[model samples]
Target: MVLSQMDAGKALTAAAAKGNPEEVQRILEELRVHPDTLNEFGRTALQVMMMGNAKIAGLLLEKGADPNVQDKHGIAPAHDAARTGFLDTLQVLVEHGASVNLPDQNGALPIHIAIREGHRDVVEFLAPQSDLKHATVSGQTAVDVARASCVPHMMDALFAHVHS
Candidate 1:
């Protein structure tokens, strides 16, 4: 019941990474662990949630974890979710006010990562936003990445949106 600060932080990080909502809530309520606390990797509960842990992410959000918090890599929760093609997690974060256009350390937004990684669905989800046209650290836009990666479907989707 009385976890040391380090133990509590590790437990919270584990819970978030596992997407265990009940365990996360138990830790927060019983252990009084701060939900927004960052892990050793500079990833918060929300950032871990972006790794496809929707349940834990939702629990953390309900407990007042800041959705907008960026990791040391400058990556928002949405970026992780998008890169991994976790649309459900991405939607939850977005609904909770996660910025889809938030860039990473290299200035790559979620949409940019999605395109480069050949995640067409994620690209589709982000294409409607007017602010996704920005370039990454290498000066490549999402469309450019898609084209260069030879992801025809992704490129088509992006072209449809960018040109329309």
Candidate 2:
């Protein structure tokens, strides 16, 4: 009845991948799956939840998943949520203590990716939470990336938040 750690990890990621909240709960409670269990890519369950499973993600956090645990790309679940424009998911991650300004391997933060991908609404929502003045490893600010990536509305949004 008890699965090994490897099996449990597989089940956990599978449940999260399918966005199965109940199954995730069962896995956490019954199968003894660690909430921070990493997959082959070094992504924890919370990071996998960035595929858009807010419910499962919440359960993972409630079970002690570290919201700021970075994956292979050196970013956390919030980066995936931001990249995909999943505002609700991103908010959940942040609410669970995911650091907003943590940059990835490319020195791109969640806000930077949001802007570059033209998620204007996400950009608007996240810009205030961003340390836009903080330059990336490449030395580009969120505003600079906005201007360079041709996301004018994102640029405008960042500017508005700043000037306001």
Candidate 3:
């Protein structure tokens, strides 16, 4: 029996998780699976790209995946990419219209997650695009997280945006 679209989507998610860009490409091309197809966890292919390489993210974006689609926790693909230090992927999502200030279920912004994960570059890239004053679920702002974590670059980025 032929696999349904949902099965193909699951396969795409698996391929992405394993960093198998070719398999993802084949599934997108051959199976005609949706680029933004949601897996069992309600995470779209774009969210899967968060932990994967830049190529897969780019391919998914090219195929029309919505960067803003959130997972079960309300964390967008941009949040995951930033949290995991996937700089290029984060950039692509941002360029493709992912809102930097969009918060997750925990109300944590992308910059907050970046700083939490010690991904300074991601924090720097996102800070300027976000409001440092926004608070998270834990009652902490981006500036607060940066300071508490002692991430100088993140702190500097936030201050620059705030003072500018």
Top candidate on TM-score is 2
Please write out the lDDT profile of model 3 over residues 7-67, one tens digit for every residue: 8778888888878889889988877888877677666676765374888887887888887
Error of 3 at 160 (Å): 1.8
Question: TM-score of predicted model 3?
Answer: 0.89
Candidate 1's displacement at residue 13, Å, is: 0.8
Select the stronger candidate by lDDT from 1 and 2: 2
lDDT-based ranking: 2, 3, 1
For residues 1-164, could you state the per-residue lDDT of candidate 2 as single tens digits? 98877677777887898788998999999887889886665566776763567788789999999988886679778788888888888878888898888989988889998888888878888888888787888899887898898755776778877743
Q: Weakest 10 consecutive residues, lDDT, candidate 2? A: 42-51
Which has the better TM-score: candidate 1, or candidate 2? 2
Clashing residue pairs in candidate 2 (N, C-alpha, C atoms within 3 angstroms): none
lDDT of 1 by residue, 62-84 (tens): 78888778867797778778778
The reply for model 2, stretches above 4 Å from the true place, is: none
TM-score for all predictions? 0.89, 0.92, 0.89
Candidate maximizing lDDT: 2
